[model samples]
Target: MSSRNSHSVLDLQSLTREQVGRIFSIADGYAGSDVSRLATKGCGKTGALLFFEASTRTRLSFETACARLGVHPLRLDGKAGTSLEKGETLEDTVLNVAAMNPDFLVIRCGDDLDLAALSSQVSMPILNAGWGKKGHPTQALLDAYTVRKYLGTCEKQKILIVGDVRHSRVAASHFELAKVLGYEVALCGPAEFLPEKPSVPVFSSLQEGLSWATVAMALRVQLERHETSYSLKDYRAAYGFTVENLKKLSAKALIMHPGPINQGTEMDSEVLQDPRCKVLPQVTSGVLIRQALIQLNCLEETL
Candidate 1:
């Protein structure tokens, strides 16, 4: 069952199904327990946060998990005093951090940076916060955890991911990991925004997707990544989850988005407030799942 803890968490691909199951089990425990119980799980341990990209939820979530687990959080802002400003290579910056001997390092950088190469250089565990447009494995983990909370089990649950799939790290991660975690996955978006050949079903419209899904996850339109300007009305007509289209969703279906939501664009305001929306639960589960990741990856223990 591979009970050994992960040496480095670059992506979910390295984790066995049993390891993933154990992580979810631990996270489930944290979700049900009071925050006070997590205070000393990583007592005297330390975690270094190195973010080259701007982030809100991922940065704060990891820091929050560190506090709850008695792990000290040290952040190196890419803009300020970091050596990257002074032409010190990322390799040197990583080397300096690794020399300090922190228990583990958490990082988020642009898509251009090679996380695999960075991991090869560091002896301690390197937890990938977001590796550009390639993947956000932890986000995928919490997402699956959140879905299981609402749907009882992930096995064969229909998960329809809607929006800019090509440039979204979360969407990419979910598309791959959701299948690994046992779900029937599908993608919906303008042809430009989707993969050329998807392993799962590809729906032309959001309405068609919602009709078949138990969970509808909206990916934020990656305007920053797109070179071609898209008409908002045309986008809405084609793929947006307007109130009218949201009505097509089954009553048991859940809605989701990896934060910093573009309220009126991808989905309407009312749908954001809908009880069936699991967005906030996904956020909440992020903290708990990260807590489990920190304990398992940074601390030596037998689960």
Candidate 2:
């Protein structure tokens, strides 16, 4: 939003090409043995992790990033030990957290809260962990980093994101970021699952999508977010990514997933074991990108 040392990464759409490059550059510096060396920079800083929804990968990686940087990660998982469930509004909880003056806050909010409104009320920097059904900017950053790490460049690369396109923040963020990052992204899913009028190409069949993509990112079906019901049997039969589906992918094509996967629905569990699958690699990249975010936002002056 503002210059370095004063801004929030609300969404990837708001990030500039140069800004994206800077984030990637910072992540590259901590890509390997350099992780433990940056502890001094974040020695006393504290970053708050305010997660309102259930999470596995995102939450843990952010915590791990803060630890690696030597920043104390104070966590308040939705209503667990906090007064949130006893009727304290998310906005009020955030305002209360802000009053304590943490260096930065990594928030994962539910659909009801207006993050932008709450963000305006805070003094500390805010990083959007997950943005309703709109976008997951940090996830996009990590995914982009993984792509660069694997393919050496993102320019003109093809990534076909398969399954549950309608409710996936991951797909929305990546598709939007593609415009600035110089890559082509396609969406493939059941008719109800796909967006009604996506700017990018859409495919109904997974096989057809894999034929054109160098990266196949299978998205988890968001039953929690869906307003209408659909048949899992029918959906899986048509769009499930399995080892058998891997044959359609080119030798160099990468397979990815934003995890906590629906074992037999979005993809078969066995597909995760494939050598070309980069889901775990994506998780590893997530930590480094978050470390970069922490440095840029929490340890701003040192950079």
Candidate 3:
């Protein structure tokens, strides 16, 4: 593996499919293992987790992952003295943090921001916790890791990603990585929510995509990112995975959500508890995958 500074894992594009596979393998080892003892491997290193947007899972997962890997975590949420609050540029904030000489930086920002550009300004490895509407590479890695753990492999598996495609970082990241990993990917949502020239197959109806999917990945409706108004009732009637649509899924099909799930909007309330739902497993895989990522990026220069 390259030195952490030589290659930052800000997006899946920077990682080959082989590298990603290796990451999942490492994550697999961490799963169900005594992570507390494992934390000692990264002792003396520090990671800065700066989130410019509101987050629950992504922020907490990264902090927990850092702790489990024995890397001290410095957290900064969407509050006072951040770039926006202080009216300073993101580049400046990152450069300031770089000066502090943290081993790595994990950042989550609005989808509109360019995290890649921000990474370019820092010498230490930068891990994109989540980036505005464009990417959530780590989440994609964990999601893929979860799928592989349950289904044996990801190659050629049909995955239908539903909802808020135009604004979801997770959807964008998953779409890019899944295509690279040879998963048959399809998008389902309203025309406004779907991208005009998406690389993957775009379905007008959720039922059509669901029927073809081996994995139904539901994305939360990102109202915060919406430009125009949307009706909840209408959205649920059309795009949401209603109880009726839930029954349409194959018994073998797996269900997943990136979470902070808007129950009754993108999915039915009961679907959260469904036997086939792998939501909790996705959360578990997230911590392990992030730990693996931190371990890889926090390696000493001599190593």
Candidate 4:
């Protein structure tokens, strides 16, 4: 553990397998602890959250997590009069905010910006909420937490991650984390949208991948600020997980999505609400996992 100013979660790959295991243990402890006691334990003294991109879940969960720990959360979303609107560079903004000496700074930026470059400019601990198409470490933590909660442990659990790997930060981190946690991982998407030679097996069709997986995690099709001339219907037909395709999953298999789910594009809305779906649990785990992260970082400093 380290002070909020002394730590940064840039990517899941930066964390060792042991550290990931410990994070889960801490998250479990936090999840099981008395809610009333959590605030008094070490609540509001930690730090703030800085997000440079649009977010509903991660931003709010981090704020709630800091509040539970009795720490103040200074939220920085781009708005009128924010330095960002003044055309100031991200480096300058981060440096200026770092000078305020907050306990932690959590950032979600769109460009898949250089995290190490940003980290170098700020002394405060940095956590990547989402960084371009690179990674989302905290999301990976919560995803792992969700899997462990339902499936007992990730060891040897067959997992399939489907959809646009070419543009998903969550997918990339989830794939890497699943592998590190000892799950047999597979990926499926259109040939143009898949990663180049991933460590795990890769498939071009959902039906083919579904045969081998005990869990299927789908990533939403990202339609960011840019509108491409791509065909949504074509993408849906080829890569989307429809109700028919959902039935192909193992009876014991779980369905997951790192959401703002595109109802008719990447997944069927009906499938999202399926009994075997763990999407809601993934959202719940985000708060607890973040709380555990803040607590563990503080504990490290004390040790």
Candidate 5:
């Protein structure tokens, strides 16, 4: 097993199964504790958060987590008031934020390489929220927690990742996490949108891929990144998991998606609302996981 203190989780590929389990345990501790009491006691407060990209769930969760731990969260949303609109470079923005003497810095940026670069320059602990096409470590951590919660253990489990893998940071993170946890990971999508040279198996057809898998992870197709004229109709025909396709999955298989789901584009609305789907739990776990990450990084620095 890899050492837990080795990295700041800029990428999911560096984390081992043991590290994932440890994160869950930490989350459990926070979950069991009384947040109101913690807020009153003010155990250990720290840092600010910087998000250079758009976010919904991640942004809110981190804010809530910091509040629960009595930490002051200073958020930058990249608007008129922020230095970014005034033509400041990413390096300068990060450096200026770090100069606040905050104990930790949580960043959600569009570039994965930039997050890694910023981590090296800063003295404070850095937590990656979501980076472009590379990885979302917190998302992966929560995903593993959800899977383990619903399916006992990940060992020998089969997981099918469908839809757009080529431009999905979530898919990349899931690939590494599933691999570490001993899950049989499979990628299924159109040949053009499929991941290139995946570490595990790849299936051209979603039906074939869903046959032996216990989990189905569907990713949204990023229209902004596409140069070709890829219509929703054509994309759905080739990659979308309709209600009919959902029936083909194993009865025990759980449906998952990293929202906001393009309902008709990547999956049918019915499929998302299916009884076997764990999408809501995934969202809830995201909050818990983000909270745990903040506490862990902050506690590490203090210790």
Candidate 6:
């Protein structure tokens, strides 16, 4: 496996299906073990996690995964000094951090910024934590990992990703990866919420979409990214996965959300506790996949 500067994970679209499968192959072992098994593998190395957007699971889990691999984590949130607070450029600030010589850089590019350009200016490996509404490769990895963990495989599985397709990094990453990974994927939401030129089948009716899904993944309605006004009440009535509405899906259908869910908007609050809900498992999958990613990119030690 390539380490350091050579293996930057900017997005899933760049990786071959074999490369993605290898990541999960490494992750499978980590799932059965813990920090104690490989605690010192990444010792003497460091990783910088710089998020320009608000995050909870993605940031915290990457930090945890770094610890499990014995890689020291340096965190930077969306707080002061991360901005043009002193008129410094984003590239300049990132370059300054690269000078510190961390093993890799994990970054979340906000405001639709170009991560590829930023990565080109740096030498160390760059891991994209999330890139605005463009991509969330790791999230897609974990989500697929979660599905594989429960269902044995993701091949030929029908994943109906519903809501906010036009402005969801998760949805963007999932569909791009799905094409190569062999999962059948589609989109469901209001016309405005869906992409104008969709790569998959688009559905405006939630119940109809739910009927065909083996994995029902709901994306959060990103009001922060929306420029025009929309009605939450109308959104809930149309796209929301309520207790009554979800019964229309197959009992075997797995439910998921990327978190910070808008409860009554995209999904019912009670559904979070549903038996079929794989939300928490996705969190667990995040740690395993991330640990594997760190090990592959930062350490030369054999797994």
Write candidate 1's Cα lDDT for 39-63 as tens digits.
Answer: 8888888999998888888999999
Instruction: For residue 146, give model 6's deviation from the true position in Å.
Output: 0.7
Residue 128 lDDT (model 6): 86
Model 4, residue pairs in steric clash:
1-300, 1-301, 43-69, 43-70, 43-71, 44-69, 44-70, 44-71, 45-71
lDDT (Cα, tens digit) per residue for candidate 5, span 164-243: 78888888887777777887778887766776677778987777888878988888888777677577897787668788
Greater TM-score among 1 and 3 belongs to 1
For all predicted structures, in order, the TM-scores are: 0.94, 0.94, 0.94, 0.91, 0.91, 0.94
Query: Whose TM-score is higher: candidate 3's or candidate 5's?
Result: 3
Alpha carbon lDDT of each predicted model: 0.84, 0.85, 0.82, 0.78, 0.77, 0.85
The regions of model 5 sitting more than 4 angstroms off are 1-7, 40-44, 301-303
TM-score of 1: 0.94
In terms of lDDT, which candidate is stronger, 1 or 5?
A: 1
For candidate 1, give the lDDT of residue 88: 84
Question: Candidate 2, residue 46: CA error in Å?
Answer: 0.8
Candidate 2's clash total is 0
TM-score of model 5 (CA atoms) = 0.91
lDDT of 6: 0.85
Q: Can you write out model 2's per-residue Cα lDDT over 28-125, one digit (the tens) per residue?
A: 88885566587787888898899998888999999999988899998988788888769998888988998898888899986787877777778778
Which runs in model 6 stand beyond 4 Å of their true positions? Answer: 1-4, 81-83, 301-303
Task: Write model 6 residue lDDT over 142-207, tens digit each, in one string.
Answer: 999999888889999999998888988888899888987999998888788889899899866788
